[model samples]
Target chain A: MTAEDTAAPARRGRPGYDRQQVLEVAVRLFNEQGYDATSVSDLAGELGVTKSALYHHFDSKSAILEVALDDALSGLESALDDAVRSHSDASAQLRALVRGAVGVLTARQSRVTLLLRVRGNSDVEQSALRRRREFDQRVAAIVRAAQAEGMIRADIDAAVATRLIFGMINSLVEWYRPGGPVDPDELADDVLRATFDGLQA
Target chain B: MTAEDTAAPARRGRPGYDRQQVLEVAVRLFNEQGYDATSVSDLAGELGVTKSALYHHFDSKSAILEVALDDALSGLESALDDAVRSHSDASAQLRALVRGAVGVLTARQSRVTLLLRVRGNSDVEQSALRRRREFDQRVAAIVRAAQAEGMIRADIDAAVATRLIFGMINSLVEWYRPGGPVDPDELADDVLRATFDGLQA
Candidate 1:
């Protein structure tokens, strides 16, 4: 869903907070306090709203979690789709995938952080993880294709390579600050360089 | 502390569980349930012991947290120290550090996972974070040194590079299972090859 969708005036709910605002606050709380530990009241207290007011925007914490996780997974899935459609070669597809993944991460840091922190505690979390695994498998397939085409190194297993490469990219959530010194494109480029080319001088 | 220290008999407490056993269960619980949400009583219940019996070993939940975090941090610190002392050249040192870290991470996967998840919610967590940051800075310094010596790529900022490299290494906690398909040494080799030698065929 677009920002506008979240930002759209709450048709049936309180006027002060939009769906996007509620989602953002909810994701932040989920990240700070463990998802299971964060109750609807905890969310309401954080938002300075009554439980009913909070419930007006979202039915349950699980609903918010599902949306937050979908935001991350959809972005990643789109990146993978775009990478494949845009690039004719396996190697190019791999590069674009890395770049697009970085874009999604920086643009939606908190949601992605929450997504990664999910440990399949609930149905929503388990579904998110399933989608994540599918995304990983898709990436690994590209790695294998690239290896077969003699574009990327064949010495490393495709699955291992995909994990390590994305591991570096996903790490952006931990330290990358938006509006910080490093831009998204630059960070993507750095990741591309480090992974595509050896760090050996 | 060595495994022996943890495995040592509880001098003042009941039989069956040792300090190491308590620390392992505590770390696992902290990893599963966020540290703040987990109480000493919960740990006692998990271990099938009374609160007093658990307290006889760990005084408080925070005490267990401290030891758990220390187990992770101390392993990392020792890895850093060994990497530094064992290698004279910065590039070799960087390689050694990566390898040593993989060793620590795999050997103590659960504790390292707990350490990575710490968000500094309490004084104990805050102290653990401080130690982790110090560790990060030292790793970055080695990256800078290696860059200056023209042993590694200099295009990316050393700090950024350091984070990305460790990020890949640290991702092991999420997926690396003991006695799994990937062995520790092989995992380290893949990481080093991907980081140091690029993935290009």
Candidate 2:
């Protein structure tokens, strides 16, 4: 069957519930109730569709999880890559990485939240974790390089520094609302200032 | 019955599995499989005892959860209280709070991990979250005081700063291993230096 032929049934059932919409709702439900606790039946119930209609959009729950996780990991990876390619100095690269990460996180809060919560229970989760660790290592490498260049502090271990920096950034998912009082730019500035300029007067 | 008489059965079942021991195991299991996923049967199986024997220590899973959450919340509350009582300035209070928090988290890693993972699924979890929010507000008030005193940088919002600082501190549970190379003192120093001195040289 053509792609349109396969998509026709789900579209008719839910009108606007396409693949992206299905993934979005699934991610929201996963974030609310947890991926392990949230079943296909729950998703179907929430979508007001039958199990078969939900299945038409995605083969299985894990398939939806993979897509949601990829949505987050890819955004981060792209942010890192753009930051690196756009900046020559490690300090600039580090700043851009933090800013870009904040952007991706705010833009895709639920997906990133789900990504952070993955504990490597299943094969897909394990792979997502591997990607996350790789991202951390890459960020740490920049920290190490910046330290070597005498731009960033050399006293703190690069690995520890990376975790702490991203720790602050990642914590945004817990408390940051998209249209909240603290806009994304201001939030990024606050994080960057707190991390780079020290909080002490 | 007396406390000793009540504890005697649990102690006899596993020889050295006192109330504290049972709590530690339950917290670990909760962290591993999540609080809701773990059942009384699961706890009993992990303890190598019958369900009734497990009940001899705690009335219900929620009871264990309440105590476990209290273990972490109380440690943090003590840290905040001691930091305030000992330090005259907000800067010192903030530093002491961070240092004391590191000590608590490192000392009771599993319990802290369980505390951070609580999502207000039950009344016990909601109470823990409320206590956590109060702790955050207390820290934010200190940040505001510090900013007013011109000790801490005033550019960042106190609430945001409080979350970022604790975010870095709380992330320790994810990666920090007790008895690891990074001693708690050194970890605290790193966090303090990174936060107060800024990472940029």
Candidate 3:
């Protein structure tokens, strides 16, 4: 095996750029600096590619942002879908959903940070915002169903309850790092325990 | 009283601007468009003032951000103080703290939105971020105390538990609108219930 053979496979996909790799770098940059603060040139420089080379893969910065947000949201939506399909009891399904969210958030922390930080300034962001609202509504529906089945308190509005629960979960993007003192599974369980069983002794 | 007398009192301070009013408007614009995206000129234009007039109160845009974040934090700190002073038990104090956060969050939603979005870009933001961390640590200490007393689950780390609970509370800035179907007081109650009793039946 020569030096060429050792390094050749690393750049096999698209000459110094993999689409997923580019998106990950972009998400990290966007998370560290405000998305508006980061420019295409900044991304290109960070990726060690020329401006034109970066453009070849993504048409525009907004396109990159669209993909990044989609990456995070896709995981969450899939999690919700799986939880709904797998569980019959609304309480169990809700717990599964919280667990799923923690999994996605922990695995995709940077992308989730970018997704949560989007302020809907442009058309791409507006679309992402719409999808987020839809996802929230779907979760609220689950809360309502759980309430109807006498699994959770009905006194709290379903919409309010859903936001409060997810707020706890979504906040993981702000403080949670991938490798930390706490394990992700334990964090998920604690969130589930707090959401379903309260923190009272 | 004449109509002229009522109109004159409306613009009572600083000939044309009030410091609190300017900070409030700045926070609203900052929330609508990110702090980095919104400029001093934009704030001046929005406030119907000359750049000099805006500068008379705030030395720089960062100064405005400083005041805006301070406004939100001051409310929260005071709430924490009152909760600690008023309640004997950690559980009651925690509930009071959550209620106070909801109150400040609802009343000063725009400022809280601005506060939450600060990314430590400048000295002003860095200071605000430090204060926020301190507040979180203080809250986590309360959680630790509560757990020690056997009033809350001991299985969860106090720091992790604090973030989870506050995550749910802080999330209000994203979806909560003051004049919607849910009242602020009721939202506070729901949050307290969700925190102490949880969502389970």
Candidates by DockQ, descending order: 1, 2, 3
TM-score for all predictions?
Answer: 0.94, 0.94, 0.92
Q: Give the per-residue Cα lDDT of candidate 3 at A160.
A: 85
Error of 1 at A150 (Å): 0.6
Docking class of 2: medium
Tens digits of per-residue lDDT, candidate 3, A1-201, equal 123333345554435556677788888888887788899999999988787877876889999999989988999999999999999988778889999999999998888888898878899899989989999889999999999999989999898889899899999888887778878998899999898889988
Candidate structures ordered by lDDT, highest first: 2, 1, 3
- Interface RMSD (Cα, Å) for model 3: 0.9
Question: Candidates' lDDT values, in order?
Answer: 0.89, 0.90, 0.86
Predicted complex 3: DockQ: 0.77
- Better candidate number, 2 or 3, judged by lDDT: 2
Name every residue pair that clashes in candidate 3: none
True contacts kept of each: 0.85, 0.73, 0.86
Tens digit of per-residue lDDT, candidate 1, span B32-146: 8788888887887787667877777877888888888898999999999998999999999999999999999999999899889888988999999999999999999999999
Assess the local accuracy of residue A29 in candidate 1 as a C-alpha lDDT between 0 and 100.
Answer: 87
Chain B of candidate 1 achieves a TM-score of: 0.92
lDDT of 1 by residue, A1-201 (tens): 223455566455544676788899898888888889899999888888788877777788899999999999999999999999999999999999999999999999999999999889889989999999999999999999999999999889999999999899888999999999998999999999999997888
